[model samples]
Target chain A: MTRTSTLSPVPPADAAAEPTRVAVSTVIFTLRRLPGSETASVALPLVRRTRDPHEGLWALPGGWLDATEGLDAAASRTLAETTGLAPSYLEQLYAFGAVDRSPSRVVSIVYWALIRPDEIADASDENVQWFDAASLPGLAFDHNQIVDYALWRLRNKVGYSRIAHGLLADEFTLAELREVYEAILGRRLDPANFRRQVENSGTLIPTDRFRTGSHRPARLYRYNQDVELADRGPLDRRQ
Target chain B: MTRTSTLSPVPPADAAAEPTRVAVSTVIFTLRRLPGSETASVALPLVRRTRDPHEGLWALPGGWLDATEGLDAAASRTLAETTGLAPSYLEQLYAFGAVDRSPSRVVSIVYWALIRPDEIADASDENVQWFDAASLPGLAFDHNQIVDYALWRLRNKVGYSRIAHGLLADEFTLAELREVYEAILGRRLDPANFRRQVENSGTLIPTDRFRTGSHRPARLYRYNQDVELADRGPLDRRQ
Candidate 1:
């Protein structure tokens, strides 16, 4: 995605003595069924820091920004390196740049992503471990706060966007879809109200297929690709 | 805001030869009524580039990230330096870090701000000038695209948040508030619908004060400070 460089040239002497460094990080979320329970919970992968500043502590999977790629590219590369899985949905979360965030002056451009449950099987890394989003340990740096913000955004976005599709298979039962929202929001939604709201949203298309093995066969539905995953307003993938 | 650096100490030898530099930029939007015009339009201040790349081209008000300051502080400082005015509302917009977007590997944490009409009086800088957002000249770097994103966010946020209060005076009639939305959205919103929507939002506090004019006296209102400027969702000003 390299194009002609457009910024004005700066003299080496004019540049500051210590340039602030940029890093890329991601909070990848998926759902995990609790052991011995039918309910699923929101879960995310955290990498144990191998070196200093909070060494031995869990942190979001990330790395320093590469000089040759865009921010999004860097995020994808770091995510793959750490977790070995491509995200079904990825978006820029926020840029954290408090002076005390790191030893050296480092600004982290954090991204939040969602991976389908089936796709999580592809992620196999030694240092990476999954933890329930609701019960995370003290993490490295300000990652605890970062994760909190990401979770808030995920829950808020689910209310309006079709991003729940990112965590589901190509087709799913209405109950399955409601479970995804329930896991993120941590609330028991009235099943009938949930069904009515989702059906009216127009982003779901009922399929002819139905899932068996349940007391009553529930109809399967697919997302309308025509409608966007979410309303990004006028934004595209350009940046 | 600086504290003792906590990250594992990096050997100077391990540092990258060229670290990615972080820059802070802001898009300050306000409403301006042109001479003899009845309706207002969205306008923003821009700084002219004085250095080599895209020199003499207009760009958003901004500067480099100071190593000692937090991201928000950097944004506030740079914005004041560029435009000589403090914003009534400022929020992180987006981070642009395309390696080829600049001559150097620069990552910009961009913010969008809103200034009330009274505050615009303080913004009289030499290189700073206001331009109609709808029709801007080719800007420096990827700023043309950045401005487009900020405008999109501004229009989108106005629909949901009390950020419109940032563009209004302390006390105003319902008609005045609607004008801010109309100017930003570039359309005439139905007065009745707009009134009901805003009143139902519970973010406005009706006052006994009224403005008597050529027609009927309209009651004035103030924003409820208890309600947040916007729903940032579990995030605070810590950044």
Candidate 2:
């Protein structure tokens, strides 16, 4: 994705004496079925900070941005460190740079990701743990607000993108897919409307597999990889 | 809008000896009626750099991220320095942080803006000049590519948001509004369909004003101020 065009060549400014440092953080979202419950909800991984201004509190998994690495590389590194998996779906959420966000001035280029259920199988690590995004307690820094924005984005993107693939298994029945939306949106959708919308989107590929239930079995479908996971426009092709 | 939630309280990482610096830049869009042409086109302001590296080459207006300023403040400062006006219809576009983007390690937090026609009246300056977004010359650094991405965002946003308010005047006839869309989209939209879509959107408030010409008078419509300029979700309320 390296290009002469997007590659900037302007001279750097005179460095500030007490220069602002950059940090890369992530809000990686996944869906977890509540213990002893049939319903699922949006969840994310957070690392209990070994040390902090707010010590012992959970924080989004991230590390300092190395001068030698690009922002995306730094984010992917953070993901691997926490999840032990390659980045499946990732996008920059925002750059949080309040002068007082931290005791020292640090700007966090935050990213949000969606890890499919299959991808979450090997993400176990002692330091990092998954928490329901809706029920988080006092988190480090402005993390609580950050998670809310990320959830809003995830829910909003689901409306227009085939990003459910990033949360669901490789194959899912329409009912199962609807559950993903219902969880994020916190409400039920008309089953018939949901079917027509995804059908018209043309991103679903019907599969022979079927889920046998107490009633009639429902055929499964997977996302068409050829169709874009989402329309990020130029960012998609450049990356 | 300040909440204790989004603020980070974690201790800062060991500062790199030579830390990556953050710079702010913006691509501000407006409609310009090219000389001898009735149709307008999407355009933006660029300032000629006075210092070396890309000296004399036009670049997106920006400056160093002051140690005490937040990312939004820095972006708004850049916008003010460029246009001498308060930030209008601005959004963080992307954070470009390629290691080799500059000779020095610089991470640029870029923003894109839309300036209404009436707002462009006072944006006259010698160092800064407007360039057609489609036909930008080899700009300073990655500005050519940056502008392309900004324009892509502008076009994509136009399809789903009432951001047309940011480019159009206080009250405009349907024909005038359609021109703004055609200019950004670079193609003609069916008038009947455009009318039906916008009318159904219910974001327009019919005004007593009308544009009388050779054709029958056309009623003018203004955006419903109560309606948001665009659905930015959580960021709108937070800001």
Candidate 3:
């Protein structure tokens, strides 16, 4: 390998003045199953930055990572700071560092989180709102790239894992769960096949509680307490 | 949320004199099948850092990102600088920012790349050597975390995609391919079922050439040039 002086010397004085800093940001998503729509749509929470750098522009809710905090703690903290909502589950998504990504020397470790839409009845702050994946405003920095990658992972992993359930309450009806999948997938699925697949996966357990509404009573189900799918295997390919 | 200023800002005069700055490093990996191994083991090319902080430590070949370089570019540049390797497929893995991770403020954005091992070998430099995943040394920083995630992803993703082929020669035998899978999965698979699954997935195309060995001529197989599996769905199921 050719050794360059560039790699040998310590970083310059200006570099030291603004030493590279660590931050944690997140793309929190929930599937909104819109009735009468062709398919459910994916929505992500965004906060308009109240400070500079990309002040006034929309971006994922995140901020500086605390030195004593772990990655997961930082993510939850940032989310709560901007959205006033606590995500139940979070996973490391990707890290964003392009030299000029920020005017300041900042590199952010991005995480993806899933939340149920009903849990967020309304925007707690004016700066925060859910934007449909298809119609998003200009995002600050390389956040657009982070959102794209998170969407790609979600779409690709849903087949093997029952990720759709995360976008819903602990107990939900079959139709409600199906709608969550359809929203993220952006296509209508055969109701029968979708139910069969979920059932076969053995990740969901039926409950006696039923959803009572306009037409008829629908059976309710909750995630299987005994089986923790994330710890099981690579893709959770049970069904 | 309550805001607190925990750390005092660095004095401007002292900041100018500090030569070294903190930055993150990355060690992207992909599976590579070698001639000697019983099966294809996870192989990553490592380069010895010649500078302080980790002067002689054998580390994943990476370095400081320019203030203008994105995290992705820094990773790509590190791979090119140390190993003369460029991967067509690369994705951000994770960030390691434990305060003690680096003597300097370097918090690395590790990436994972999937490519045919042949490509890496052909691009090999004097400083680079491929090490089996199961048998690796104590790496420079939190690289062990990055490697662990990559291995976990390989073990998880190979079931759905033709990821093993990314580690093999363009033309390979079924036995060679199976070894790659077994090495990553860490288990013995029924060869008959494995073959059946690969064929049924429709990701492999049979080539006209055959490899003549001690027993018989093994038919050569190549990755299907066309079928790209669409992203599966959301990743937030159990959460």
Candidate 4:
């Protein structure tokens, strides 16, 4: 159902006016391998805030929520404005509404979006860079909190859900997929067991493509388009 | 690590004087079965707003976040103010910050809290009453969205996690516990299978005390305090 509201631009004279609230921000993340390493790692997009409210500080790329748009739409718009990136997968994260969270009385509803590393690379721009999740610099506002929560959710969700696939290319080998899980989880998984579990889950459909130039040719697979993993039972059981 | 914000509050005259944000609220829930029922049902504690901005509207009791308190504390305080109740289980839910969600400029960070029905019964006052989830009326602000998300999470989460036990008393029978699950999920579960799954989860510890009642004495169980389910595996896998 769509929710719409028509609000007057001005408040009644007798009523005390509250501060205007409108800002949309995002914490976009992707899994990337560190230099000289085959093991994957979590990375977040960072932009140096050019204006006040923690100007010059490293923060997630975001800006004001538009007055005439949905919060989700505003998030994508803000990310595009700040980093020139459009995320393929976006979902609402927690809202930060502490009265003093912003220098002004600004409350930010932060959305977390996942972009495949390849997607980010294709749309790469000069100002934006992905930093290792562990070595992030001090962030502006309550952004660090947002990042923490997103990381926590990502790590936890990857176990039972096929969300980790969102971080990989469309067609990937079993070894590459396992690396994605291992990276976010910060632990090494038994490669054979991990592949077995993933295949048994029925979320992945086998593709004819195979990866070459490795020690051996590895089979490639794509996510099942018709299979909405979240709706499936037994397979969708909480991790 | 404690993250301390060092950005000084911008003066009102500064160009960075952003509009103050709005408050988002949520009513977290769990089912409480009254004595006469064979099945349990969902319930939420609500308060009548005594002031404007939807004054006198029956809403999920909440208010704007204070300047000094964190979002979590603000949510806890708001819940306490309305129902005189404090939930043992509380977490950040999605934030609702539609520009027109509030009559005033207030962005809310809605939170979902879970509590045993009996624990909150004592706090029920003139303004507070536990209403069946299905029978809720039009709520103030965007509370309907908050409740919907919470219920969705509850139903989805109870499958693998022992979170349902948080809604029960210190010790409860398998039937009563199963009722909690069935009520939230809105499905009738086979008693034999439910028992088997719960037993296999190993999160519940059997108690020596049997629940003495009209028919047969049912076995009592309690949440196993010793084990940390969240730490057992990845967040999703732990469940």
- Top lDDT model: 1
Cα lDDT of model 4 by residue, B201-237, tens digit: 8788888999886979888888887655234231121
**What TM value does model 4 have?**
0.81
Off by over 4 Å in 4: A1-23, A52-54, A97-106, A121-126, A159-161, A227-239, B1-20, B34-36, B49-57, B100-106, B122-126, B159-165, B227-239
- Residue range with the least summed lDDT across 10 consecutive positions in model 4 chain B: B230-239
lDDT of 1: 0.79
Rank candidates by lDDT, best first. 1, 2, 3, 4
DockQ of 3: 0.28
Model 1 chain B lowest lDDT segment of ten: B1-10
Residue lDDT tens for model 2, B146-216: 78778777876654236557877788888888888888889999999999988888788888988998999
Report the backbone clash tally of model 2. Answer: 6
Of the candidates shown, which would achieve the greatest DockQ relative to the real structure?
A: 1
State the lDDT of candidate 1 residue by residue for A1-239, as single tens digits.
11112234442443446567778899999898977988899999988777887778888988877778888887887887777768755789999988888777788999988887788764345567889999999999889999999998898766423655688888888899988988888988999999999889988889999999946998999988888775666665745
**What's each prediction's clash count?**
3, 6, 28, 14
Which tens-of-lDDT digit does each residue in A93-113 have in candidate 2? Answer: 888887776788888899887
**Which model, 3 or 4, shows the larger DockQ?**
3
- List per-prediction Cα lDDT, in the order shown: 0.79, 0.75, 0.67, 0.66
Best of the two (2, 4) by TM-score = 2
Ranking by DockQ: 1, 2, 3, 4
Candidate 4 chain B TM? 0.81
DockQ (model 4, Cα): 0.20
